[model samples]
Target chain A: MFDGITPQLLFGQLLIGVINGSFYAMLAMGLAIIFGLMHVVNFAHGAQYMLGAFVAWLLLSTFGVPYWGALILAPLVVAIFGIAMERLILKPIANLDHLYSLLVTYAATLVIEGLIRQQYGSTGLPYSSPLPGGVNLGFMFMPWYRLWVVVFSVVTCLATWLLIEHTKLGAYLRAANESPEVVESFGINVPRMMTLTYGFGVGLAGLSGVLAAPIYQVSPSMGSSLMITIFAVVVIGGMGSIAGAILTGYTLGIVEGLTKVFYPEAANLVIFFIMLLALIFRPSGLFSGTEKS
Target chain B: MLDDTTAPLLEVRDLRAWYAESQALQGVTFDVRPGELVTLIGRNGAGKTTTLRSIMGIVKNRKGSIRFEGNELIGRRTFQIARLGLAYCPEERGIFSSLSVRENLTLPPHLKSGGMSDEELLKAFPNLRARAGSRGTSLSGGEQQMLAIARILRNGCRFLLLDEPSEGLAPVIVKEIGAQLRRLKAQGYTILLVEQNLNFARSVADRHVVIEHGAVVDQLSNEDLAADMDRVKTYLGV
Candidate 1:
């Protein structure tokens, strides 16, 4: 089964896996944060990711902004859009059942996708490789931007982990997760925290989108399809945990990459199949400390 | 003695509160003086929890005045009420099972007046020190209750509304909790405790109030409560 797998091809696939993993890690990290604390499984996350890419494309094509500026501006722009959704759409339904949040967000996703499709058309828009060189790593040739994506994503994930786990705001967030009433007593406004947390999570999706624009063609449907795979990663990782999302995202991506080398037909189905197995064996996901909250 | 010169720390007048369509507290009235340990004794569903919930503004569809140190509590959010120096420990013991005992204790946001330092908080509850690194779910039930109380203490709230601190705990742990209540009282913290255990109520309550079917049935000092066991049994079914 492994006879035809060359080191060069394997290394190339691994590089691809790591890139995919970076996106998976970033997107799933956002999903876990929102779902865990706010109890909102934002179906709009993928649409936000797509919007991030579009924002970057628009900035570059229409305004002649550089890639560096789009990297920062696109996420901020998308994050504001996310905040708007939280305030106008999600906040009213905050007290309703979790299913309503899912339904509302799904509706929002459809609306966003439709609007983008209307403007951008269905054909994939090409984003020129902003960093136009590669480093030869003996077994594999690594694009500088791809390497930058991997490095930047790792830093983002680590920063997020520290923010949630080590900082004062993170403490309140965890406290809110435990007992919002007790946290409220301390005079930390919880609803405001919820709004910001949702925005931040959506911001993470947006960041992933911008990073991915240079790698793949910028398209409205990009985030919609990617979300399914990321959801599988979240399932295998568990929704209640941050580290679980990050680790599972990268691990599953590598597993899928390996599957492509060994059994090409199974590559697409690998993550979903692993999610099923995870549900059966460890329903809480790999790093999830407990069952559902 | 109830403070007469200054307004009561908490005043609830004609407070009507409900859960969805079910009226839990109807025209409830009470006053809790500063530095007092008050107990609300009632059978299950006597609106004991509802009264506390109303004060915290957690109750939906509430009408009436809940003035905490003179601020209107009716429209304030639960977090705002809490920031106003009131802490509510629910009956469910909402511990963050994923966090360590120490992390759970330290996770609350800081307060301006100052909360207990981790060192002092641990000194106050040595049992917690032993289980500081343990996950919240790994601790025993009694330990969890201790952790819950310790959590508020660490947050440094001066007023506390505890719902059934002694429920489902071992008698030894109940006595331990009773001791902590006395210590908290001596430190000048005002507490409104909802309890079913008459003995636990008698141990630390400076004054006692009884509720039946959403109304105040009786109010008495600890001395009067000890003297009138027959009436207590009749009202509380002790």
Candidate 2:
């Protein structure tokens, strides 16, 4: 049964799976952070991600900006929009139940997606790779752009992890999630932190969007499709654990790829299948702690 | 004690607060001068905790005035009120369980320049130094209580609103907490504590303001408390 599959085929699919995992780690991390800190389910996360890619596309097509500039500009612009959205839109309903926030953010997705669709339409836009070369690594043709994505995502995730786990600012963030009332009573501006943390989380989604734009089509619908996978990753990883989401992202991605190798029909369903098992076994997620933001 | 020439450090007047439709504090008024230790004493559901929360701005549905250091406090957020040199140690000992003991101590920012240094605080709460690397919640109840108070001390918050410091603690720990509070008072710290433990209150506080059904029913100096013990016992039912 294994005779037909070559090393190249196995390694190639694994590389793609890891690439998908990178996006999952980034987007799901943002979702986890937003949910953990603000209790906002942030259905607009995928939409915000789509906006990142669109921002990159718009910058290129409208202003003749290159990929390098959009890479820096796109996430920043989307992060600003996220901060404003948090301040003006999300803050009003922040005191309400989690369900209300989830509904609001879900509604926001439709509105944002609708407006972008009105401008860009349903047709997918293509983005040329910034790095065009590939390195042949025995069995796999490793694209430089793919390598860059992995490196960038790892660095971004590491930086974010260090920021939240090690730094003074991170300690405040963790403490706030544990008890915001106590944090505020200690003289920290928690409301402002919520707004900024929400922005930072969405900005992560936006960064993934910029990364995703080059690999996938830059369409309004792109995030909607990927969001289902990322949410599955978040659930399996646990709702608020930072490292859980990242580790689960790559693990499930590889599992999905492996499923494709062994049984093609189960490829799409593999993640949900694993999530179901995880829910039954570890309802609190793989990592168990009343832990960090 | 040095002469208190200035106005009272905190003045809360007619502060009515609610938890949704249920009223918690109704026209509650109190004052704390510099270097004073005041306690709000009451039974359960007597709004003792509510008064502390209202002062911290944790209870948002509050009406009337809360003036700290001559600055209006009712409309301000908790953090801003805290920045005005007020700190609150909650009833449950709100500890960030995931954070190390040291992290919890340093989490609260220093609002003033001159307060207990980390070395001084470690010297004061010597047990905390041993469990410095441990998660905050993993400590014994007494240690957690010590950490809760110690967390705020190094931040230069001259005023503290401590809620139930002796709740669910051993007699030895309670005595320790009492000793610490007296030391803090002697060092010129102002505190407003909420306590169900009448003996603990009697031991540490300079004055006691009694709360009954969310209103200020009585105020007594520690000297007056001995004379009014029967009356106070009736209010507390202990």
Worst 10 residues of 1 chain A by lDDT: A284-293
**Poorly placed runs, candidate 1 (over 4 Å):** A1-5, A290-293, B3-6
lDDT (Cα, tens digit) per residue for candidate 1, span B46-138 = 899989888887775899898988899999888778778888788888787657888888876555466788898899888889889888878
Best by TM-score: 2
What is the per-residue lDDT of model 2 for residues A175-249, given as tens digits with 9 covering 90 to 100? 888899999888888999998898899888888988988899999999988888988999999988888888888
Docking class of 2: medium
Estimate candidate 1's RMSD in Å: 2.2
Instruction: Single out the weakest 10-residue window by summed lDDT for candidate 1 chain B.
Output: B106-115
Under the 3 Å rule for N, CA and C atoms, how many clashes does model 2 have? 0
Superposed by TM-score, candidate 1 places the C-alpha of residue A90 at a distance from the truth, in angstroms, of 1.7
Please compute and give the TM-score of the first chain of candidate 2 against the native first chain: 0.97
**The TM-score obtained for chain B of candidate 1 when compared with the true chain B:** 0.96
DockQ values, each candidate: 0.52, 0.80
